[model samples]
Target: QDNRISIWSVGDLGNVGLNGEYQGEPQLLCDIRHNGDVMDMQFLDQERIVVASSTGDVTIFRHHQNNQTLSANQRWEKAHYHVDRQASCGGAACTGVICNNPEIVTVGEDGRINFFRADQKGAMRTIDNADSSTLHAVTFLRTTEILTVNSIGQLKIWDLRQQRNEPSQILSLTGDRVPLHCVDRHPNQQHIVATGGQDGMLSIWDIRQGTMPVSLLNAHEAEMWEVHFHPSDPDHLFTCSEDGSLWHWDTSTNVSEKPSFLHQGGRSSTYFSHNTINQSVVSAWLSNDPTKDRMEITNLIPNQTLSVNSLDVLGPCLVYGTDAEAIYVNRHLFA
Candidate 1:
């Protein structure tokens, strides 16, 4: 990430400031109205960021470190939309995006998944109706496989190598129907993933074992939105919810299991969940920390409340955005 090219918004294409630390006064970099609200964005490399919008458009912006400028390199329109076997037309809104080097994959509200090459102007491949409901999130299981969650609370693994549009494996949340909002893979384990949904519930799925979740817990009072693992500290995790709370989970004590790798399709893969989590699934995994086992949660902001829409962690620092159109930044998260 370019430190200079810092502040941006998801709800609008408003004026963005280049320097995040410019507290004295704000400096505007670019102010171009986007096609629709920006849904997601990902780093293509150190130099470029690709942004996906609700209007089914994805744009790549190149940050010129030397000049302190950002330039639009390319844009793909209607990359994800609805089209039946009969070629029926129905426009769709883009929901999720993932970047794996030269390949770009995007899923949309129309339940379609599209793959593109950064150099190409349009989608090279399309999986129509990847889900019957809105596809909310997607992540890569391997270079040739992708995992996606839908409004129906179903998680499916799509094998890109297959000639068909069907997924190779599917996992259901429960007997009840609750929309899944976001999904994140474990930083250390390959097959482990945490899914948060509309009912304020969180579940962990071990893809190699089967479609069933290893553990489920009531994580929030309202709908859960985002989940992320510490980049280096696999023993910890963070989650945000519409209930206006941020939760920090510590599972250091439960992390005693030996690291194991599984082989499938002739490829050896490691579990993303840290050692203890790789083998066991407990409801309150956070309470395992021996040093501070008594206090498992620390509300990032205890005095006031606002629905946390998104949040992320990087080492000791944390940043979150709320529905009130405000951003909170905190340092020394682990401290």
Candidate 2:
């Protein structure tokens, strides 16, 4: 719980064996003290990093590659806060932050969304009341559009080009509002989005279609913490949960090609209508025929039961952090 941002260089993982374990310790690059509890962080670029805090402040830090030290660059103080009868209360936590090179977007418990440029000290645009509840996470659907998940299981889409502060569209879960915790968009298909909720269910949505999600897959046993699509291979998905499990979902196999007798005459219909979707271009996530829609799931951590808080997958590497104050790296993900 010590609010600190530490950087480490995981030396060449090429030596990691087929077992996927790396016995060597990561080399400490630098450690910097943060203003408040670090809520989220992202690399602004190779030389800079952006951090969001519980104090509702967002700061950019410069990492000196040669000296291996960090220096504060730009700071946006009190970017989010609760207003009561014209008085601003203690700053609300900036829960999520995303970077799009020069542009930075932050969402907070105060239900505010702030947009900033790396060179500017002030927010370029502010959506004062983006949501009535806390915004948990955000991701860019397109260069000009962003999607945000809130405390009440609602996903709202905002268009940056619009002068209006209101969201362009809203989508939500069917029943009791299970707070959504994390979200990630498909690397290859911008229209496909995945969200994880407090109920541990994984919902896949085609933002171009109806308001409801296309598929709701039963996943973790406890609150699902994070979900990510492999940066290079969109067919591979990763999810970590409070139940202390990290799962790898593989949809690479051609399960859709297998003929199914479930459809007697016409095209097969599954959880969602795929009649219009071209099989060759359609994502396996939108597979028709429930009988043939099979996804192989592998639990990465089966023994430990402490919460797996966050995870990221890039190429053949998979790294995750846990509530037990440990970070695990699996280098041979594809093997």
* Winning candidate number (TM-score): 2
Candidate 1, run of 10 with poorest lDDT: 282-291
In model 2, the runs with Cα more than 4 Å from the true position are 84-89, 255-280, 288-293
lDDT of 2 by residue, 1-335 (tens): 56778888888965676588876788889988898888888898999999999988899999999999988899998888887423455788899999999999999999999999999977999999999999999999888999999999999999999999999999999899999999999876777899998999999887876787877888999999899998877778899999999999888677556442223136554333333322323467765332145678899889979999888777788889898987888888988
Tell me the deviation in Å of residue 192 in model 2: 0.3
How many clashes show up in model 1? 6
Q: Once model 2 is optimally superposed onto the true structure by TM-score, how far is the C-alpha of residue 107 displaced, in angstroms? A: 0.4
Model 1 per-residue lDDT tens digits across residues 64-127: 7666667778888767666642333444678888899889889989888989888897678988
Q: Please give the distance, in angstroms, between residue 38's alpha carbon in candidate 2 and its true position after superposition.
A: 1.5
Give candidate 2's whole-model lDDT: 0.84
Q: What is the lDDT of residue 94 in candidate 2?
A: 92
Measured on C-alpha atoms, candidate 1 has an lDDT of 0.72
Error of 1 at 124 (Å): 2.1
